[model samples]
Target: MECLTSFCETHLQPHQIAPALKRHKLINPVKNLEDRMCKKHKKPLELFCRTEQMCVCQVCTVTDHKGHHTVPLKKEFGEKKAELGRTKNQMQQMIQKCLQKVKEIKHSAELSNRDAEREREESEQVFTTLVRSMQRSQAEVSKMIGEKQKATMRQAESLIKELEQEITELQRRCSELDQLSHTKDHLHLLQSSPSLCPPTSTKDWPDVSITQNESKWNVQKDISQLDKKVRRALSELEEKLNNVLEKSKGDDLKRMQQYAVDVTMDPDTAHPLIIVSGNGKLVRTGHLEQNHFYNLKRFRSRVAVLAKEGFSSGRFYYEVQVKGKTGWNVGVAKESINRKIGGLYPEQGFWTVWLSFQVDYEACTDPHTPLSLKSKPEKLGVFVDYEEGQVSFYDVDTRSHIFSFTGCTFTEKLYPYLNPFDDYDGSNSAPMIITPVNQTP
Candidate 1:
């Protein structure tokens, strides 16, 4: 068989002409016409196998595709073209979703840049203040040293003048006595001897050396006083830095609150001993395990519960009140974590900060790092940036940062976690309450 390209009416189709018209062949304006022929049967495929959703020849329909619903290939082509239109619509929707995600990423980057700039400015302010303080202290100590040196020089000059005058008087007395002895004048000699014998008219020349040691002692005393001033200045500087840090924390708290979300306890994932409040705002441990229906989501051991809400992307912040609770754990846990024996480690799908023994605190990590906080936080703030892989904890009462888990890789949805830590002793009996954040003014 041969093919030719021409207008449909002008070209003589080979199938229509006899073998004598070997110069002419059918011209198909549509591309890939050969693909319409069945390879095995060497025949034009005219039917479609609805079961296989593929074009087939009539021979294929009665043989390989027996009992399968078949339709005209031309009809199937129309349906497939319409189906492609629907697929194109679906692609548009997927494209729009990706565009939305791109916008979100860009917005987050912008926010991160803004925060970095603020941090830089604040750091410059603190270092500038520290440098100025040191310079002022240095100037004051230098002035004291210079003034002391001048005073010492003046005292030495005054003592030297007095001693020089006494030497002149003694020399004059000796010359007069020599003159009197030569002139044989007993009265003059006696008068000069009495004056000379009186050890000159100098005022008590005993230990008349200007004591450099005394001046040194005065400088030392000034230095000691300067030390006290430096200590006081340093203490003031510490207070000032603390004030700055506290104000920054307050500002950050307000910012974090902008992402604040309302959270409630979920009883399904809670331990058997845990009790979720009616309002779902609080959770506590009961002395005895409650009789409940069997649930795979429930925590059978640890006295912990997950919030009803879960986040897979972006940022979220929430606060919890642990005022009366002596021991508690608060943070986020990845979905699909072990419910039977929940472990508070990132490896175990938990990123958390916990308090134990009333005062000790730790950020749950692979090794669980210890944290020493200055003030006991009656209220705690938890913030998570899923894309950035950061989970931070704050002391709401003191407006201070307690700990942060950084460099994490989260691939699943995260749920807010809370545990009241059911201690055998009645000390940790307080319920962990989800509270509204009080943003500092």
Candidate 2:
């Protein structure tokens, strides 16, 4: 069959209006006008098999499609056309919904990108300020040490000058006495002896010495202290950064608590002066050193212990109670940490914080970083993300953060480390207790 427009263009001749009546009739031609015959029987497919859903001739209904539900081809065609119209409408609605979803996803992605960029900028700024502060602290410490050395040297130089002057005066007096002794005249010699009974000195020199030890200062000790000050400054900056990030989002305690695990002390790794309870949860310093079986892994100096459980990957959290304790150290340490030389810092695979005299709170960085908290905490929560290399501390009582050590590259398994500082007159006798985690509401 030929399309109407093509037929009109070829037969109607140029400049002809083309008959509208024929065009309109062709557009709405009756359905089933064309005879579609099945080749098997060469018969027109005038009937439809509803069960088979295919066009069929009358003979097919009686033979191949025998006993099957059948309807007129035109009637079935009308129903199917109506069904197609409904399907088209549903397809259009689905397409519209998918387009809206695409828009929403794009908007969310844009917001996420913006947040990431802003956070990146903020982190850069914070680190820059921290570096500057550390540099200034280093300069100040160096200047102070240099000035002390100069002052001591100046004092020594002034004493040397006064001693030289006394020696010169004594030498002059000896020379005159020698010249008088050599004189031929006895009267002259006697007069000289009377004058030189003793060279009159302004002051008596009795046991005067400028010992170097008295003027010497422990440069390493001074530098270590100054390093602590610098670390404290850095810690504060980091705390502020963490707070800002947390505030922009929400508290991370709940998320961290999800990884909470029970921690117990390992007696084998403990110092002889340290005692771990049978349950492994409690640890305290002993007044008298216990003669336990000799162990190579035992702490040699500081009274500290390591937990039985060690983590190599993923996150973990634990809680400890330090109530009534005057001094204590609690945190995590790498498995390979030198237990023999127990009092270690982060650089030496020990990441910890300590309380001294129940007043001073500090983190054991290379140079101990002092923490200034709003209030002392009896119960503390520790969180560690091994892969992320983050160790954080929280004051569980106030639900406030204490400090966090980040940007570490962990290779070995890390275990919880604890230290019950030496008991001095029983003032620091309280145990560093590891307690069960009671999730905060």
Candidate 3:
């Protein structure tokens, strides 16, 4: 003010001066302000440019930020603080969700450990039973051979005793002959000779010999009988094992149904001859192509369709009805299965069970093995454990496992597969209907 001379320095009031000015810029005071100064204009940044989302001076609103919506800095600060509070609440909710998931994962781990222990105990028992059966069979066979050997020893001992007795009698007879021959009187000798009569006991010593025929053991016969017995025992064990396994399968089916998924047919993937229902639950082969537009995803030759959903992880289950279908295949196939040409078998990325027109059922494996199902499954259940790499088919009505494809390596997503074979002679024209799963109690 003294330099300008419009107001005298002597007239300046020290009470109006800031303390920072006297303290040598402890904070910005009078001569040079801080970052609050607008770079373009030498004015304080007092307003927020709402359009640019930044602090601006009043001069900046008319210059770089012309015709911009501006608000007081204090008002924008309050709004931003409220938004941060809302974000904090959202983060807290997310953290709670994460914690809840942690608890679920821990519970699942506990169940898995329990199941593993059960399987371990069961396996040990089965192997132990098998070993005991073999040991018992071996002991029985050994004891039979030992009895044969003992019987032979007894027969030889009896022969040795008889020979010793004969030797003693012969020796006694010779001694009596010697004594009689030495007698001096002829009358004594004649009397003794008539009494001796060759010391005959009416038995020939030359004919008395040990039996030379050796006792032969029919060991091969015993071994064969033991083999047959062991095989029979194994067969019985197998039957028992199957009964136990089927019972367990019934229980497993109930657990598997918990992962049941609603499956709908993917019409885009259906073959031209296949007619998909409007609700996407059923599909059947028609007499001729239904004039549908050709889609690249469709199965060109095979009369098959895929479910709309595909799974890449975890377990899933679905059921289908083939009550009247004589020739159909139901199971799962990988997404990369050939849409052009190939047999629908495991080699072609299909794990399925099939029924032919002659009512013959088989699993479509590499060698196409036959299946000895007790009865045809009117409704079939397909279960896939993606991480386990297992695909199983079950007889839904009977609650029995029909077949399982195990030890697979699935790198791609798998889809539910349905194949109603070509309607040859119209005997196998029934539609395969996707049905809801009814879990076993």
Candidate 4:
């Protein structure tokens, strides 16, 4: 009241404020007629009935709205205004949360689109490069075959030309002899006989044959090998790509590496003629007899040795260095393999890759399946999942898989087998050494 009096004193004169306050208090006659009188009671609406939700006179509030919750109009107005303000604030916060979620969803969608496009481009490039490699291989094979045929045909043509010249000279001699027989010139004929000494310059055609079919057969064989190699290369590439993608999640090589064990050659199982190095990691053919007494587990004729450690279950990996050595066999074999049979075959409990003369790598099987390799592996990594019944071979140098034997039921223990077969030349005299495996990155 004091603040209002001070505001009125400052803004207006005391007598002039009375006229202004009377005008502000005056209600519109049309609005007051409806609001001031109740329709049914014909009395001024004095109270608000909260239960019946309507304006009512004091008598109606006691009769119809009696025994129900009720509140004054001014009190309900204040509560509803406060609730409206809270509702406005809650709605604003909800809108802000929705906007933040929208930003996160849009960001994820952009990243997905970019990742999909990049993978699509990479797939296109992989297939394109594969096609180009196949074309290049075809061209190289064709050129090699053409050169071989041209060389053989040129030699044949040269021989044919020389034979034709010899025939021409013999015909000239025959014509001269016929003329001398028709004439009475015995002296001239006798004198010409010295010049016709049985055509001594003629060459002996000793069945010269152009073995064209043999060359064609060899080309066919080489092309077949090339086809297998290309197929293997593509498979390897796809496997590597899959591994790279899976490495984002986990790596199998790392898990296998965890099971790595140090392996050495066991001289007890080695053949008497096989010499093991002092370190027990190298083995080669030896001229001096081992002098050790023969045993049931020892190999007799096959220059082979077994690893000191044998695996019965679980996975294991080891590497061997075969660099600069030919005519060698290395892989896993059953502990009960025949010692005297000297046969290297799967049915005989021997599973190995054989490197021999004119052959790169051949897996010992019933028919000895030849492996098509891009190059000879200098270091070979062997992995065995004994529980899973799988044995895989890899080129440690190139970090590529070479071969695998799957679905093998190992009833007994398996040992690493190595055979440094009689060396081919001085070139193959290098010992087959077991090298430590370098863990992959």
TM-score of each: 0.67, 0.46, 0.64, 0.45
Tens-digit lDDT track for model 4 on 331-378? Answer: 999998888875787777887877875466877777877788877788
Span of ten consecutive residues with least summed lDDT in model 1: 1-10
- lDDT, candidate 2, 388-439, per-residue tens: 9899998887777889999988999999988888887987777878888776
What is candidate 4's CA lDDT for residue 46?
55
Which window of 10 residues has the lowest lDDT sum in candidate 4? 1-10
> How well does candidate 3 score on lDDT at residue 109?
65
Q: Give each model's whole-structure lDDT.
A: 0.82, 0.79, 0.81, 0.76
Model 3's lDDT to the true fold?
0.81
Candidate 2 Cα outliers beyond 4 Å, as residue runs: 1-35, 200-232, 244-441
Supply the TM-score for candidate 4: 0.45
Whole-model lDDT, candidate 1?
A: 0.82
The candidates, ranked best first by lDDT, are 1, 3, 2, 4
- Name the candidate, 2 or 4, with the larger TM-score value: 2
